[model samples]
Target: MDTTSDRSRQWQWPQWILRAAAIYNLVWGTWVILFPHHLFDWTGVARLNHPGIWQAVGMIVGVYGIGYWIASSNVLRHWPIVLVGFLGKIFGPIGFLGAALRGELPWSWGATILTNDLIWWLPFAAILYGVFKIHSDPASRIPSVTRGSLEQAADAILPRPQSSNGKSIDSLSRDQPILLVFIRHAGCTFCRETLAVLATRLNEIRGLGLEPVVVHMSSLEEGERLLLSHGLHDTTHISDPGCVLYRHYQLERGTVSQLFGPAVWWKGFQAAILRGHGVGRLSGDGFQLGGAAIVDQGRTVQVFPAANATTSLPIASELRTTLQCAAPIPKAL
Candidate 1:
């Protein structure tokens, strides 16, 4: 029943529509970048009294607009970037709404918010919807993680032994519920901070009848060194250099790359800024990455995956809540 003509027609429409949307976003983004002050004036957010502040705002908005243009142009190829842009489009308006409701934001900002937020929402939504449609099409079917499969896979992938440890993950937590703290490699400052927090909260975590097991994508030697530096030498640790666990738990990078195409410069810039301020330090080797998941008895009870390394994971309380409701598993005999 399917012919070349039928296939060509099917591919033709979506591609044409996507290209049109990309052009629109590119044009709009360029406009905003070229005249950020005018765009801000139109939006009614109070004009910055300081030229320095205006310059900063212009730089930020211009960079974001360029990101939007690139993402929209290659929606299918860079779906993650497009998705992030869409998130900004949606949340930017919500933020304005909240500001207006609280009387902290001026009504004038709504005009610019309309241009930046509301105007993009429909198109972004359409692009997202189209992406899903394409993904769902019979021709484009790809294996995805469902809750059930993910739970099963998480169990299998997580319980392995590091060659150095000579101990299995399950063996380390035989007497208590394992608090598997999945972390990014040493390149992430947040991960280092998290290790410090875990050290500080060791007693509390143990009090809850749980044993902490730290997981990272570094070598066991590197992981141990980092943990020792933070005075967490006693905590059990595992190295997952290949990110096999990351893939198994569906903690892969999100849609950001679809727009900006792996932002090495941005990542480096952030690292430089962090280091300059004495706030955070990036890995000298540039192995910066992010994603975390908590598993218990083969079930993915919690995930804190981010599109980029800059964001922080939820704190201990939120992590505990996620673990508390972890799907029940059979008690060991």
Candidate 2:
């Protein structure tokens, strides 16, 4: 019979396998990056219509290779990078399925997506899950706080402190509803557009007796600049660089990359064409996108969970409607 220690030792094999997979990713990614055109030619795919395109592809593949190499070293912080890679793999196949359904791509494309995306998808997920499990466990604590709990704690730990601006969360009217819009860091175009929209409709939200709190991961100065750039100086702005609020509110989830490896370029092209822009690039390469959650009275009442990178959350109107009928907002004061 195997002893407990022996079983524990047996469990170590998965980590070794994960390391091997990481090495494989690094090698394959490097080949693709260094010989992109040659790889495409050998695969019978046309050289990208533009020379710069191939260069960009090479650079991206090279970076991905570096990421895999880092992840293989068993660095705890790099797990998110590994998760993004897994998402890329998964999204690639799903895109193929969509293409096949629309009769836009051949069955071979679907096959390619399957082999590239689904292959090792499960194992990668298991690896991530195992890592998170260990990290969450007190013995192996990774210093993570759960989303639901964190949000509640934020309400208590970081009470709306009064500042020069008299518009703190504490000062807001108790009878009115509040919209806490969490914006991404400066690099996110979607967040910028979303902020613009909010700015345009700031009065409309105010007309509905709703206060809008613009939350972002930046310095107070940066947050103020973002608001000013968007013509939203009057909006309440807060900065939380540690993503403590994001994690506490459970809005920090992002898709993995293995799900996206196959179809990313194509989707980028589609987006570019749709927007009438010659250059098409998927935002953040189908990973590293944030999520949204709505809460009231310290309870999560609504969550617009993302199925994948391509899926869009409901717009402001829809989100508002959903929140309207949600459980009553808590009166923390």
Candidate 3:
């Protein structure tokens, strides 16, 4: 795991690369604009009938240079700029090849292509890869820890995972075993599906004597707002932003197959598109998996790790873990 500072450092290379690219493009554009036929003469090609057309192309490249300069500040945030530029770089060479083969352009012009387009391919691809990694895998935002440290932290938190209301899981579950429901990033479609299920089956869960305590990796206010939106105002909420409880419960970071497998995609489509449990923006660690457990006296009596991001815990009646729970919270105002 990495921290915010580390992630910030990881993005530095892309920023610098983009900045250099911006300067290079601006200088190249200006050079082409000022002496449109200079490169044609160097490349041993006759001047165009209207050199203004080439200057117009130079103008367009200059505009792209401005976009790259803007994008350099936040490479990940301005992925579209990189994406378009990358495409242009790829296609520009192809166009050059076609012209060179048809005798409209000299092979010597490929020298310009190498500098203008070929040189940027790797760094541009790396920037795009960084963007994809940062978005899909948020583990970089989490603090680093060893297995021993994680075990110690989890040991301390699992029995006493602090709640928004200042009560500990151990204290709250002393009598009525709390159904500790762990969910992934708040934006996940399965998270929405699970919350909707809990909200719809709140009465059913309480009827079975399990006071559902939803543990999430978000702020107290954010957890409350998301839960309240799902009509789960009465359910208890635990804000575990560090995922100590998650590590304690053995819900490790999901694998690629578990998180983005074909099955998960289909299920996500079903929940988001068909069921209308729309996804939201990322709230916390996107890599963490979700699970459920019945905690009695802060000790896990029954555990149910989710099979994948798409398959959530059957929280209400289907939980094989028979909970010896009672006394649900009073209705929210």
Candidate 4:
């Protein structure tokens, strides 16, 4: 396959658009710095007491132009920069709309919003989506798992909890079905999102005869803090900072698209912002991916590899449907 040829053909328009945005940013930033008062006069905005602050904002916008120019060379690799720009673009418009509604900003200020934020939204969003679509198509299948090794892998991950009173995952699966949920770092917004979801649905899941066991790549104390905040203070979780169980279950590290693409940002906004599960301090590798598996006795029945770090989980009703489709439960561990 000619990857270079493919990339060249696919990226022609996107590269042009990125460069266009770079030029626009440079020109706009220069204008704002050279005559910051012109913008206030034109938009009917009140003059800022500190004009230098406005000029500094222009400098930041001009710096973003440099980042956009560099990103045009490889939009997929430099997507985080693009995402940051896009987020700014998104929030800026919302801020302007709010201020205008409150009569703090003139309606004419929308002209700046139109040029600085709205116009670039679609193109930046499209580039992000394009990167996601292109990168998500797996190039090849993962190494095959023979039954013997698969069982070994399952056993390695579901071994008895080291504490004296803790039950093994295998033992838990023996009497009923189990939902083994792998999580990223404790501080990840998506991890907090997952905790939020589970906090609401855990009882319903238990009613469906499935016990949810959370696995995290963080210290137990940190994991407890995240879970407890989300009303999951009593949830059973495994803290595996080394990711030993993650590898055994074949959860790979995330790529840039999987971690920071358009879809991730959108869903993250809903989870971390709209849902009020605010992000917090970093606890572990932010790029570590997670997954879910259904276990019955010692055998793994179903696996859902996470498409991205921020993939929204299936709701309780959906899990019930999956549980219905899973392999029959056994009687003993």
- Candidate of highest TM-score: 3
lDDT of 4: 0.74
Question: CA lDDT, every prediction?
Answer: 0.57, 0.55, 0.78, 0.74
Q: Indicate the worst ten consecutive residues by lDDT in candidate 4.
A: 137-146
Per-residue CA lDDT of model 4 for 11-128, tens digit only, reads 7777888889899999989988999888898766789998999999899999999999888887766778899999999999999899989999988888889999998988898888
Model 1, range 1-333, lDDT digits (tens) per residue?
A: 222233334444444544554565556556645655675566566665664655555455556656554554445555676678678778888888998999987787787678666776776676676665454232222223322454354344433326335665555545456666666557655566567667888888777666777777667787888889879878888776544455555554434342134563465455446543113443321232455555455444566665555544456676677677756543311
Give all candidate RMSDs, comma-separated: 13.7, 12.9, 8.4, 10.1
Q: Per-residue lDDT of 7-52 in model 3, one digit per residue for the tens? A: 5455688878888888888888898899999998887778999999
- What global local distance difference test value does model 3 have? 0.78
> Least accurate stretch of 10 residues (summed lDDT) in model 2?
137-146
Evaluate residue 251 in candidate 4 and report its C-alpha lDDT on the 0 to 100 scale.
80
lDDT of 2 at 193: 55
User: In terms of lDDT, which candidate is strongest?
Assistant: 3
Cα lDDT for residue 157, model 2?
49
Q: Which window of 10 residues has the lowest lDDT sum in candidate 3?
A: 324-333
Error of 2 at 204 (Å): 2.5
> What value of lDDT does candidate 1 attain over all alpha carbons?
0.57
Q: Candidate 4 has what TM-score?
A: 0.50
| Model 3 CA lDDT for position 23 | 88
